[model samples]
Target: MNDIGTILGNEQFARKQASFGPGGNVVPIPRAKKNRQPPHSDTDRANVLPLPSTNIPHRTQSGLIPAHVRVLLIQKNTEDRHACRNALQQTSDFNVELVEAGNGGEGLHLACQDAFDCILLDCSLPDMDCLEFLGRLTELTSGLQLPLLKLVPPHKPELAIEAVRRGIHEFLIKDEDGHYLKLLPVLIQRMLDNRRLAHEKQQIETLYRTLIEHIPAITYIASLQISHQWLYVSPQIESMGYDRETWLSNPDLRFQCILEQDRTMVERAFAKSCETGELFHCEYRALGRHGKLHWFVDEARIIRNHSGQAMFFQGVIRDITDLKSMRDELETHRYFLDQHVQSRTEQLEKRIVILESCNTELCNQLEREYLVCNELRKANNLQATMLQAIGAAGVTVEESFIHPET
Candidate 1:
């Protein structure tokens, strides 16, 4: 099959009718200069129309050329329908099976009978206003996404403009030689590619929303201003006894919910983060339904614009009431245990002082007893020495007492 450059060249050379301006007047075609770029190769033609740049998932089933496409061709004239069919057959990149309809009623009927990958609409269908037909078609297939490409006559650029205003996906001008028909395959491919991109984006958004809504924490986006106006809050906010709508609607409700004692701490942290463009983190207590106080760990960061100016805040709030209670309980236990240990240590210190005093008194008594023992030994030795002297002197007191003792 011929590529896009060959097709464009064929269309240009085959043109027989003069172009028309917005006033419906003839515009003379300029003759091509001899200085022209050489014909583009297949690779160059491929480069002329590349896929849009995006991070969406790869299109395995739908790419530059879909595998099989069912197109609804709505043109009243049989000759024009046949020409469109012939043009669609010129390409080898993909296969298109046409379902032809003579008028808008027949086209809508055929659309209801089955599904179509795209719709080829001619702006000049008989028996119906084109806009009315479009409105009816939209109503009938409200759930179905039908991408329509309108074919407008060269003299009726107003019709093309009006069709665009009415949300026509794409349009082409008709000509005498019907060379404009050759663009059908390329246009259809581009329209489908765009549709696929839109579908991928929507799917990604839905997946992310599901994940955020079901998680155990509440996610939020808010303004960085002191008022802290809420931009978005996840459905999980309901777990904290506040509805999502209420949290979003009331700008001051978030601050009001915070415990009075912790409001300053939260505000200070938020201010510091906004000034420095740093992470805002703080633990605070908030009043829930029925005046119940819950502890929360709020973590947020300043979202900045390209120039590094703070734009807004994105954050997550986790209910840490259970964790906070456990920590407080542990602290209380530690405090009491410390007091008990301190009391026991003081008692032990007093006992040690008393025992030291008793030990000193016992040591002094032992020294005095040692001195008395030394004196007693000296006295006994002296007495023994005197008795020895008395025996040597032959003592007369005992002999004088023994005369009357018989």
Candidate 2:
């Protein structure tokens, strides 16, 4: 037996017996303290054996095992195995199952067979070195698990460093003293917490990547330094006629693609926006990969600190060449239509003036004919009066009447 077992035996700390009733089994009571008399006061008795309360942080029974948190513990030492088991027993909140393996080969076998939340590996296993085992672990759990922690001896710090380079999560050293056993609980808790955090971080990153990918427009982030580095380019870079890595490496090339006429305007707007920490929007022409000129609309805003200083700019660029072309065509058609309508209106006005002059001439001719007719009627009346007077003076009446009739 180990030194821990020997000490427990000497202290007469018996494994308390428990009874299994219909409801379930009750927790075994710890051995009574020697030289301690029973308490007389109610408060003292309550303190001696505290009843389990609903307010306790941990449950009496372990919770259901989560699909993501199946732990595999691969330790060759029997003492380490027992320490881990005891630590898990203390943790009643989380359900963690252990898979023991004596060597790296057996560990790899188990890892391949099932998914795991975290892998606890010893650096000095019998079958293989830690580095080789880690390489194999990486291959086996590629796109499967998060990461694995390396178990090392207290004396070998170099082994921990090498294991970390091989993509281990963290290194744990075995302590010779009994204090190591006490620390096992805290270590296990930290490991579980780190695993959960890593999984959450990965999920958030994936969601962000998906969101950026589905956006219809091109999106990117650029630094505001004099050189203007491309901090992040969206996955749409390929459709932009440039690969992501090529654009990231070459800032001068990107600048060269900007139209010479609008480059100054772009720079001025960017500088003002950055200084004032305001949104900047501009339209400019860009040269595509095939040397074809395209109109591009860029909209960006300054990302600022609490003190209101610009840190960087994130923006999107859209190819507006087709839109601009359509707008120009519409404007041209509108101008031609306006000119045609004005010409037709002027011609109609001239024709109306000529028709009005013709109507005035016809009215003048009709007025002259009416005056002549009136004059003739007046002359005939005067002549008739003269003839009637002559007839009354006894002149030849028949000749005068015939002359009047002629």
Candidate 3:
């Protein structure tokens, strides 16, 4: 419901919509004869609609439009500059600030400010060649994406093709009646949108790199081939005493770092996982810089395609030297505990055997004593019978009890 001002603040917006008249040409509209309204303040200019085109730029869900899109118009022809300005002035929605430069030198100078979002470069410049200017601009914004729309004369379509071949972002054909001016805003908006998208993509990539670089482990992507070509390796690889470039360039460098004793085991485990599309996991000792042996736990999963064919490996290697030290220390303690318990068990078993032997010896001695007492009792009974027989014969028995000790 925002009222974007009509063209020139006098004509109705619908009047600017012209149809094809005769021989497939846009019909010209007559200007309204009404007195123009006074210039609007800055606040009113903020809501002006962009130049009308089939593709109208929509405001984002935040209901916010770009503050202003600064354009560097590099054209020496005063009439062309006036035409471009008049076309731009048609809208008030997204403010289009145009800065005119009569020659390539001034344009390049203005471009150095790095303030403009897009550039309108004329193929024919009075002072310098457009290509040379573009080259210098490229140098100025080496890692940046700036949209440059080249304006080509309708007669010299070859210039547009040449500029495109020479790396111009986009090109527009100029006609005598200035019909191409109608499409100017659309092309500029498209280029601006593309530039915005490129900026966002670069920011996302930077954020991803920052996260990867600061992590505790080395993350990598490797090809599934036997050579195991590395696609990407995190900057954390430097902690392992190898630079990222060295690790990525030389596929065998990782294996070379592994200790001779553990190299075969790690290789076999990795190969098996790669062949079977299984998870790869192995712990091995590797020689770091200055012959420092460190333990590392490497784990990876086989990334497969939709057809179940292995594609590559996405993996992480953690420096487990400290963790391995603690684990080995615990194992040593456990081994000593086991040894101590075994020795204690053997000692207890020996003591039990000796006690059993002593108990058997005591049982035998008690049985022998019982037999001797029984014999003595039998002897006493015999002596008593003899005494009774002697009493019948009037013979006295004296001290007839036989003692076994005697």
Candidate 4:
């Protein structure tokens, strides 16, 4: 009975229990604190527990599957650092590239320069306190979730507790015999998986917020429930002289502000959007708090569920009062301009006909003038011929009398 009890509660069994994790097949270590004995001498190695057999590490986190994980090991001790590097590199599942930083200051400097997949920070750094370094590292990340693991000495469980209180994801205790190094890769894998999921979620939220804020319009999510409740309204509600909180939970405020003449049209359009799960654009006038009629345009679409059912209406509403006024004024100017152009065209047509008549009379008068000038030229030519003939005959008669006397 003594032999059986001793075998069941041996150091080998304790080691096995201590190494078990939630993911590993081995049984987990109990939460109750227990005294740890000094390392056994080599002569007792005949009864030492064999290391757990693992073909490939179960290091994968929930959402991430990295081909190579970058690990920055900040350890002042050379032997411990070497053990950690070897364990990480020997992992068969994924490649680990180990980087060493001797002190906390250097670690902080290194951390700020590049984005690492996992950081193995020593809880007792030489240059600065490990807690300070952690805080500074967190500040530098600017709320970014990077997989960081703190390396604590096995003797100081209080430090580990404090790190946990300060929101450190996980911590490690360096084992002098290098047995603890084997667990590093699995811990890193788990951290990375957790970080990936957190990052993806934050990314989605940021994208949605940025998209809604940049639209320069009121982004809305309307519920189809009683009074057509509003689920959300963007900060642009200030443009309508209303607070964001008041309109977010209330539905009738906006409708009450709509001009009585335009309420039915807007309501019908809103109803159609709720029914069809299709948000259409529409323009309507609403009375402002100052008793001025403002024009607005609503454009939206419906959010549907997997069952092809309408869940809610999501869309943007914009103020188009200036545009509407400009369009109406342009139409008025166009109408007046059209009438002015028609009247001017008629008057110009009448003047053109009178000018055409004057042109015809001038043409006839010019033709008569051209004919009279031709007749005058003929008369002048005939007179000139008569004068020449008279002169020539007088000269001929004188010559004949001179010749008869001879």
Q: Where's the lowest-lDDT run of ten residues in candidate 2?
A: 1-10
RMSD of each: 12.6, 13.0, 13.9, 16.5
TM-score of every candidate: 0.69, 0.73, 0.65, 0.48
Question: lDDT for each of the candidates?
Answer: 0.74, 0.65, 0.72, 0.69
Clashing pairs in 2: none
Regions of candidate 2 where Cα sits further than 4 Å from its true position: 1-68, 143-145, 182-189, 305-309, 373-406
Q: Candidate 4: lDDT over CA atoms?
A: 0.69
User: lDDT of candidate 2?
Assistant: 0.65
Please write out the lDDT profile of model 1 over residues 191-221, one tens digit for every residue.
7777766666666666777887788898888
Select the stronger candidate by lDDT from 2 and 3.
3
Number of clashes recorded per candidate: 0, 0, 4, 0
Q: Write the per-residue lDDT of candidate 3 for residues 1-406, one digit (tens) a residue.
A: 1111111111111212222212221112222234544655775444433322345554332213254566778898888888888776654445676778788877776666536667899989988888787778878756344678988776777777777766677787665656667667667777766656655666666677678668898888888888988878887777778877777778888899899999999989988998777899999999986688889889999887899777779898999988888999999999999999999999999999999999999999999999999999999999999988878765223334443335
Using lDDT as the yardstick, the better of models 1 and 4 is 1
User: Where in model 4 is the C-alpha error above 4 Å?
Assistant: 1-203, 326-351, 392-406
Tens-digit lDDT track for model 4 on 1-406? 0010111110111111122112212111122224434544675543322322333345554336576566677878777776676666555556665667788777776666655677788877788888887788779866544566877766787887887777677776655565556567677776676666566656666677778777878888777775777777777777777777776655688899988898899889878876666657788888766677788888888777999787767778888888888999999999999999999999999999999999999999999999999999999999999999999999999999889864
Estimate the overall C-alpha local distance difference test score of candidate 3.
0.72
Deviation in angstroms for 20 in model 3? Answer: 41
Which regions of candidate 1 are displaced past 4 Å? 1-65, 127-142, 153-167, 173-179, 224-228, 264-276, 304-311, 372-406
Greater-lDDT candidate between 1 and 2 = 1
Residue range 1-406, candidate 2, lDDT tens digits: 0010111101111223332223221122122335443424665333332111222222222322232245567777767766766655554345455666667777777676655556778767877887888888779766344456666767787888887776676566655543444334345555555555555666666677678767866777788998778788786766658888888888786668888998889889888887777788989988878877788888998777899777778888887889999999999999999999999999989988988888898889889999998999999999999989987776666668768864
